[model samples]
Target chain A: MSHRDPLTPFLSVDAARVRRNVERVQAAADARGVALRPHVKTHKVPQLARLQVEAGEVGITVATLGEAETFVAAGLDDVLVAYPVLLDEAGLRRAAALAERARLVVGVDAVEGVRRAAPLAGRVAISIEVDSGHHRTGVAPGEAGAVAAAAADAGIEVAGVFTFPGHSYAPGAGPDAAAAELAALDAAADAARARGVEVPVRSGGSTPSLAASLAAPRVPDELRPGVYLFGDAQQWELGRTGPDDVALTCVASVVSTVGGRVVLDAGSKALGADRAAYATGFGRLLDHPDARIVQLSEHHAVVELGDAPLPRVGERLRVVPNHVCAAVNLADELWIDGEPVPVAARGRNA
Target chain B: MSHRDPLTPFLSVDAARVRRNVERVQAAADARGVALRPHVKTHKVPQLARLQVEAGEVGITVATLGEAETFVAAGLDDVLVAYPVLLDEAGLRRAAALAERARLVVGVDAVEGVRRAAPLAGRVAISIEVDSGHHRTGVAPGEAGAVAAAAADAGIEVAGVFTFPGHSYAPGAGPDAAAAELAALDAAADAARARGVEVPVRSGGSTPSLAASLAAPRVPDELRPGVYLFGDAQQWELGRTGPDDVALTCVASVVSTVGGRVVLDAGSKALGADRAAYATGFGRLLDHPDARIVQLSEHHAVVELGDAPLPRVGERLRVVPNHVCAAVNLADELWIDGEPVPVAARGRNA
Candidate 1:
């Protein structure tokens, strides 16, 4: 150890803990005959992405073209951008560059989107994003085949389908949501098959729903979960994972103790203001789970400890954010087991 | 410009607008006979900090040692950390390093804090943080003298006092709350003077309170406002600034538009989820202010244009985040005008 305090408000990813999560999720997928294609958005570290590949993941799923580029630059051969990507001239150029390095896959939902991506038809593969009840993006599951057919008509190779089971993060919804997600993927796959298109890869899974959903019979061909590697307050509240499963935490120092409240140095800037609908507090205190973050600002988090005593001014405590993905995006680097490690692919937001 | 679709989730700082705000706030401080030391936490961009310094400001204020280190590395001299920092060995060491480049000033509230900072007493200057009715951090106004006296006894040079008029950020409470902040700062100054302390600097002012408190004569010797440089949704809601005054905006692409709603490529990952207490929606759409951000997932923002029509998919829009500071913290680089510039001090979370 350098004997120096690691960055105060940065996420510390325990490499060993992250490896355990990868194995746990990989085993779950293997047990159900599904391929695990872990989402690279959570860690956004190319090292972790490589570790997933080393751990026998099917491939990698990214949330942005920037992420795909980062992974491709790190020698990853196959990557899927699960977002509804609009291929403007710049996107097409990036896709062209990415095609040279890896088998780049882009997701689209509309006919215009297919037409927009026509320029990259031969350069990159396309996936139709299906809306499996999350209602955020993607075409309806029944309409997935139509979009896929349009992409095929545009000389683009349709590489199966994908959906984000975002609602699975809600409390009491993971298993059912995952089951619904799988069913929707099946429906989309059936639609594609009806058109004589072979749907090779079916992807969907969030951290909260990964275990429950990936365990179902007839699991999809691939799972793209991002937050499982960093179990946050939402995962803890939903009982998807135990406190010990969390691999990443925000270390903050006590900055204030006034009026029975202890304030932390890390606030929205560090922990992010991503409050899970199921979570009560802003974040869970690793050292004191009973404490509640009653108030948060850009630079200060006012913690209200009920029966539990708060930490002293000089004390440092680890904080598990309510939403791991947002928390990871807030930080520039990660402390690997309390050691600051640069997130090489961080800020690659395209 | 690289013509890469503006990097889907990058923040763009409008130089013209930010310069206008800098001049406006500087004039407000000058009218009140207070030195402007705008807090650099909101933008975290060294260029903006330098702009403020050039705008006849006394110094810059930061909330973290990481921020101080970043500014110091950028050749900024006088910097005050507004938060009551805990002086761990790491903090003391970083402070010592910063003291070599800049006049690092830290906030102290208690005797233990003073003692903790005793190691770096000869290296850095100290500022007693006084509570101005926010009930967050800092000691009582009357206790400022005691803390300053303790720091002075511990061989630390006291540089007067500072307080965050956080309550002034509350909507509709600007003038009265700013009055309260001035009164608290005045009381602390009086206490310091009575205790035989010089009490040269009395720092106070927030974005919402700046127009009111900073314009009031004899409010304080120094003014520190962070969010004004990058006016956010909170500033718009608090009636502190107009849309034209907003300098920073998260420029995101419309990834998907289905069912009369548009899904933005930027989610909490880009805009951040720091919804101010009175934020009307998840964020403010510069082009479509009426568009309600119905939901925000990890990597997607769902904007529901119920009765109002929204832009089509692939259309780019500027989004004013609820809190600019938190949003800046999430991003690693910024698109100024049309160029992607590294926010050199972006990830200094320590």
Candidate 2:
């Protein structure tokens, strides 16, 4: 904490810890001969993306075109939107304009998505999304051929295939989810190649699946893990990262202590109300590990102090949020050991 | 819904519905002889606050000094920060500066809060918060006298007492919470009056407890309800508001329909991830009333269409979030009938 008022909730990132985490993931990917394209959606800051790139990341992955524009404006040229984009006419124009400044790659899961993206064929590259086991966004492995063929037929370059092993976020589901991810990527690549389209890039991996991704027999060409740089309580609960690995923490003050419960100034507005199924509480108090955020309002996090000594009003505490990506998105700036760094891509949801 | 890209998730507010809701609440408060002080934390826009004030609201309630500064700068004079403020030297200086421009009122639950606020005694008015079964922030009703005496002893004017019946958010808890709130406020006022302090402002109420508050025998002198302006999924589930009463919705387009699941571009980043314990889902799709958001990622909302036709890729839909306050806070601007209104106090979570 700096000399600033501790009563206000602010996000603090340990730059050294983030650098170490970046280097650790990069080293693991390097040993596997895979490109580590860290997702900037977690931090959403150009400086952190530059650090990851400097530490040996091939490129950066983003969730929205606005993020791509933000990073591109920050001078990071190579960017991949790892989301299936269904752009309107205006969006197509924006995407085309963004492509002029950077090597933009967009993801497609359906043929309609590819057809809608046809206007940016020569300017933008397309990656076919294959659903491994998350059952969220990607198409089936067998359907990847059709989507890639459609993109290729529309003069769009079929760059590669990508899948998110999001199910690995659950406790004890990492290995199976990673195996499924690798199998799906391989199947999609094989299908695309069978259709006479080259599948150069194979991207898959999340924070929990990083080790499994590195240990897989069929390794991906690149990994897209977002939350590794700033581990959250969800990752910690999933046994992917230890408490020390968490880089970002919300610094909040105990605003009220009534009925043996502590109310923190940081609520959903600061920590983000993201609770994974496997996560126990809204967030964990770093100083008092026994404290659990039992309830969250817009401006108050009601914490059950349990057997821990009651935190006095105005005492500052650090909280590890359940989801760092959501929490980081809520913050306007990140404090790096007292230095405030603006979250350049904070509200770039579009 | 405008010429802009439909695929980008954006918040849309129904101006007509907002106006109706404001008038409705104002009428109810007016009939009950209580001043309506709508919490600006819900819709942190100066324009909306102006509408609220124009609709018979006595003043506006904010959660932070930053928000007070924002509203004051916008020329809305009467502002009350409803949270227990613990200010440092810089914070005190900021408070004094803000008090110069507006009739600022700060809440205090502990003696330390009052003591810290004593430096700005003449400039800022202090309110003692009372715990009315929602053990989130306030001191006990019996202890209100000591807190008021301390604030008065420190040369701070004891304005009134306030309590947030936040527990009323749950189903079937509204009446009991409202009764507790009225009883606590009455007890606190009596205690303060016995301490020779005038407790004129008796502020309390949440969206769920609106009816209960109006029906209570010992009604509060003022009401401060935030979420009634924009009903959410949680409110609907709690039977507090009907679907038509919801004024705000997240307009998102279906980007992927894989494995029979519809994935919208709006995820936790747009609709917010605040899920109450009794809530059914992350959010409910307005078009498909039965559809529930099964999972949420940074930019993907996986919706499970239960017996409803699966939303096609590129199809636009409106989603009612589980918590509107959290959702609105995530957005940079709110689209009011195709007009973009900047959320002036979006991240003023100081």
Candidate 3:
């Protein structure tokens, strides 16, 4: 351990924890006869995505064309860029090139996207993104018909109707958000069907709402939960996953013990600056769950010793980030069993 | 311009703005007869650091030893690692190697760090970190003497003392935070002097508090302000800088227009998720400051059109992140005059 104690403030993936999480999600998806297309945005490592696929996922879901390109280059053919990608000439060109070697399905919420993607209409496909109460992106459930019609009008393949239950991220909103996704997917499918689109694919799921949504009599044909691969503090606090399910942890060394404040080297840069309103702290101490990361600076995470023993300076601690997706995006690579694996799609915001 | 329209969600630094910012901070530091040791963590671009050095910064400040190594390897001779690095064997080894290459000064706030760096007792020097009002890292102003004495006890070089007025990053707290920094630095210097430490370097300054702290009769011997190079929304809102002073912007494409919500590809991943209590939104649109970034997901930033005209899908907008330091840490590179400059020490959170 001394020889391999990586320079403090690094991300490490527990392979066992990862396998447990993958199995848990895959088991749920398999039982319900739903196709699993786990979002790769949570753990951007190609190896992790491949693990999920081997564990029974149909394909993989990504957030951007750059991410899709990464996965495709890594040899994953089927990808759903599940964001309303506003395809400009560059985007269209990139999509066209990607389509040459893989099965790609972009996402669209407005007619403008369909128009912009007209150049690659036949080669590439698009899924209608429904709002489903997240209100962050995607059109409302009823508005899905117009977007689907525009895709058909543009001669683009309407792959399906998909929505992200992002509202599930809120405190105690899992069941409600799941209900929203269920209703939204159902309405969107019917609306697209009414528009004479086959509506062959209906996809919806976010880690927080996936479990609750699965309890419904009929779930979406496809699921795209991202963070189930590495449970985050938000998911753990929201009752979506337990502590044992968290696969990733930021290994941080205690750098300061000023006035009893146990400060860790893993600050915002390492754990990410995501303190959702409901999040107990900036992040959670994996070993000492009682401790709270009260503040995060550029390179210091100040903790409050809440029944947890104050960590001595130079002692290492494992931290669980609030939003694993955002946190993982900050790292260049992640350590798995003492070996490093590049975050293949990290910094793919473009 | 057409050829240079980068893919959505990337960081870009304007050369002119950067020059103006450097000149602005440098001019003030010169007037006060203080040294400029600009923190490079905000930009993390080697070229920009060189630009600042050419403009007359005495040295560069980094958050980690790895960052110091980057700048040192890039030909920087002087560096001050501004974080209280809790050095283990690996950390000590890295510090010793860096000290041999550059005039490096690591920060220390606790006796434990002094003990850990005992092996590098003669090769490296350390500055006592003083807690002004931020109370993040560092010892309280009065404890500086005890910590400095420990370094002396360990037969290590005690350079001086420094503090970050992080509390200045708040609504209408700039002046008070600066005042607190001034008093803290003064007390720390006196404390160190009492402990028979020379305290030649009395460093204290954050971007928000730099100007106000300069108003004191006598400023510290050195100023270490990072964000002044790239004005963020937080600084602009605090009246520390104007819009023109902002050198960095996240170039993001409007990807969705669901109902009235204008969603950009610059979500938490691109623009960063640091919305301080005082910040108006997740981030500010550089061109359309009237628009509010109401919400941020992993890959989507939802904006409310507040007097600002709605951006069309596929149209790109420049956004000023609320915290430039956190935002820059997420990007792999930054565009400078249509050329990509790698974030030299990005992800060097250690």
Each prediction's DockQ? 0.60, 0.64, 0.73
Compared with the true structure, what per-residue lDDT tens digits does model 1 show for residues B128-227? 8888888888888887777777777888888868888888878778788788887888888888777777777888888888878755654777778888
TM-scores, each model vs. reference: 0.94, 0.96, 0.97
What DockQ score does model 3 reach against the true complex? 0.73
- Could you give the candidate ranking by lDDT, starting with the highest? 2, 3, 1
Q: How big is the positional error of residue B53 in model 3, measured in Å on the Cα after superposition? A: 1.7
DockQ-based class of model 2: medium
lDDT of residue A282 for candidate 1: 89
Instruction: Please write out the lDDT profile of model 3 over residues A106-190, one tens digit for every residue.
Output: 9988877788888997899989888888778888888888878888888999998898887788877878888888789889888
lDDT of 2 by residue, B1-350 (tens): 35443336899989999999989989888898989888989989999999999998999999998899999999999988999877777678878988889898999998778888988988899888898987788989988988888888988988789999888988899889999899999999888888878788999988899988898776889989989988889988998888888999999888888777888889889988888889888899876778889788778888887898776787788999898988889988888877888899998888
TM-score (chain A) of candidate 2?
0.96
- Residue-level lDDT of model 1, residues A148-233, one tens digit each, is 77877788888878898877877788788889888898898888777767788888887778877756766777888877877888
> Which lDDT tens digits does candidate 3 get at residues B137-198?
88888888888888889899988799998888877776788778878988988887899887
* Best-first order by TM-score: 3, 2, 1
DockQ of 1: 0.60
True-contact fraction per candidate equals 0.69, 0.80, 0.91
Task: Report the poorest 10 consecutive residues by lDDT, candidate 2 chain B.
Answer: B1-10
Residue A119 alpha-carbon offset, candidate 3, angstroms? 2.5
